[model samples]
Target: MGGFEDREKAFEAKYARDEEVAFRVTARRNRLLGQWAAAQMKLTPEETEAYAKSVVQADFEEAGDEDVVRKLVGDLTAAGIAIDESTVRVAIEEMAAEARRQFMEAK
Candidate 1:
């Protein structure tokens, strides 16, 4: 019984670690994407990082990528980037499509 409990604890710990790693990887990917988008707006590196972090904050769990893209569009617009809704929508769709591709690839 003691060995069984120990094995269960070990399994839980491994799952926790995996979840953390997955979260970090997703976070880093979003930050990188934000930085890439910010570059197109001619923002400084620090500004880009700030922008990226903000994007990460809007994740809101399952909403995830769409929310990030939505916020990116809003932030860029607020920064006077001259982007319109149609363009932002298009970009969001494209990104979602790309993510779908990556997800399928991973499987």
Candidate 2:
């Protein structure tokens, strides 16, 4: 009985760790996506960093990535970047994958 209880506790701990990692990865991915957009928009280095932080903050506007996507699409369009929502969505996916890979490697 003790062994079973220990296993359950271990599983719960692992789940919590995974959730934290996932949140960190999503933030990193958003930052990277923002940097990419900033580059495309010809933002200066200082502006790029600030823009990335704004992108990270945009995630808080909702429960999921839709808010981030919407923010990116609107900002990019306003900056004359000529990007569509689908392209931003694809970039978000790609950045997420890259973020996960980088996080795993760091672990």
Candidate 3:
């Protein structure tokens, strides 16, 4: 019983840590994507930082990545940048992969 309880506790702890890492990676990816978009829009440094934070917050608007994609596409279009949803989605996937790699390397 003691061994089983210890194993259960370890699994719970591992699950929590994995969740935290996933959250951090997603946030980092959003920031990277925002900065990429901001650069394309030629935003100033202050504006870029704010934009990045906005991208991170955009994730909370829904359960999936659509919210972030919509925000990026709309903002980029409004800024006169030629962009499509498919392109933005591809960028998101690439950025997410990069973000995961970076987090893994840092660990």
Best by lDDT: 3
TM-score of each: 0.64, 0.94, 0.95
lDDT tens digits, residues 1-107, model 1?
A: 99999999999999998887666656666666677578868889888889778766778645546677677777788778877657766755665555555655765
Candidate lDDT scores, in order, read: 0.71, 0.94, 0.96
Candidate 3: which stretches are off by over 4 Å? none
Over all chains combined, what TM-score does candidate 2 have? 0.94
State the lDDT of candidate 3 residue by residue for 1-107, as single tens digits.
99999999999999999999999999999999999999999999999999999999999999999999999999999999989999999999999999999999998
Tell me the lDDT of model 1 at 57: 76
Residue 74 CA displacement from its true place in model 3, Å: 0.5
**What alpha-carbon RMSD in Å does predicted model 3 have with respect to the real structure?**
0.9
Regions of model 1 farther than 4 Å from truth: 61-63, 76-107
| CA error at residue 80 for candidate 1, angstroms | 7.2
RMSD of 1: 5.3
Q: Per-residue alpha-carbon lDDT of model 2 for 19-74, expressed as tens digits?
A: 99989999999999989999999999999999999999999989988999899999
